[model samples]
Target chain A: MKIFIDPPNSLILFDLVERFGHEPLSVMATIQERVDNLEIDMPPMNVTLTDVKNGLKYAGIEVPSGIRGRLAVWGPLIDQAEAAIIMEDAPYSFGCVGCHRTNLLVDFLVRKRKLPTIEIDYPRTEEDARNMVIRVKEFLEGLK
Target chain B: MVRETRLVVISPLSEITPDQITRKVHSLGYEVTVKETCYGAVLEGPPETVSKVMQELRALDPLGIYSKIRGFPLGDPKRCRAQHGSRPGFSQLQTEWQSLSLVEKGLECALRGDKAEDIDIPERIPVKDLQRFCEEVE
Candidate 1:
């Protein structure tokens, strides 16, 4: 399953999902792939307003001003996801995702896409950790 | 006074193991449990001690260590915010934090000064303009 992990930058979740044999899809890796293949040597970006507008639609972010910028980067991430794992209260995100607006949209998108999702919190204790792993494992296994 | 606690991750490029990390962390003398997670160990402990340990670990391997702050402020009751009977809480301050965790990756691609080419910006939002906007966020 191509599980779309929001915050897709999480090292732990990325590893765990892959270790279990499911492909982990993240916005970072997707964006990196796009940037790496930019048309040989034109400027960094040579896109138009319509292209960005479409990206916003794909990414599910709706704002009057800055949505275009965010959509440009995250649009493809939404395109490639099959399932989702939304980890709440992830320990030490280090400012990777700060906009609550985007957060809500991600939630909205998961619902809109009707993707199978498992919403969880970063564990605070050994028991919590154990249960979290079990829940995640069960969710992944169910995918098969 | 509120004490600080955190969940720290020590990622060693290809040079170390969780056991080695546990040993190194143990030598520091703070009481923490170093759990063996996928990329490395996730150690939980007081903030100051965790910071010192993280610094030492980084010195051992400059670009490999990573640490993360967990839920509430270490020991601050105000973070509780329920006011006992007044407020209904965000229900819990840390409950939905992970949802707000992805913009940094976007910032990285968009704010790349010269070598930036990740997405299709809608003209008005140039990379330089986005970089400036990112700088002002915090």
Candidate 2:
């Protein structure tokens, strides 16, 4: 299964996904592809020049392009996923997910995609650690 | 150059005190806001300096430190405001902490490797040779 891990830059999760025999979708890998392949010339799909000029004026009807620009990058990854492992409150990892605005947008995107998802909080204790591994292993095994 | 604001989490798996860890990292020369939550202190600061402080803190409890870089620089007008900005409000800090606590624990489980007794395991994880890593940094 293609496992989309949140805080997409987490090498730990990236390694873990690979260790479990699944492909991990991470921002680090995505950015590297863009940089390596020279895909930087295109415009972001979620935002347009009109949206930028309008800003947040329409409230519920529209959003700031900053959020959209990010959504454009991560949204496709979520769509390609068969299952997802999302970590909340990871405002410390090296990904766009750490930013509050992007975090919320990603969460909404995950929900909308409706893939088989397992959400976990970042762990702090041995017991929490044990549960985390158990849950992750279970989620991965479930994919089989 | 715009300063990058980083949110760093410290959580010692063993019995080490998080507050003491906070005090030790605070003494380092970076201007940061240290908030101690359930998972650990979330230090917001510039990226380069924060990297320096993290080296020191990681030596104290290597597996404990986990950081996520933020999009907005520290004290950006868009990020600071709740009234106009889409960023999360201060009330959400606790919520974010609680949520990331899971990420912290999950990180330990994933990164800790199967053999805690093997020193090489520590090396493989971020800590790299626990005692030696600390000594070199010190």
Off by over 4 Å in 2: A39-61, B1-138
Clash pairs, candidate 1, are A89-B98, A92-B68, A92-B69, A96-B103, A96-B104, A97-B100, A97-B101, A97-B102, A97-B103
DockQ of each two-chain model = 0.02, 0.07
The CAPRI classification for model 1 reads as: incorrect
Candidate 1: regions farther than 4 A off? A40-51, A58-65, A92-96, B1-138
Q: Rate the local accuracy (lDDT) of all candidates.
A: 0.52, 0.57
Worst 10 residues of 1 chain A by lDDT: A40-49
**Candidate 1 per-residue lDDT over residues B12-60, each given as its tens digit:** 2336666767788888777654555444555555546665776676566
Note the clash tally of each candidate: 9, 17
| lDDT per residue (tens digit) for residues A1-144 in model 2 | 888887666534554565456877765445434433333343212234543444333123366566655565666687788888887655454225545777776776777788898887565555655566657766776787
lDDT of 1 at B111: 31
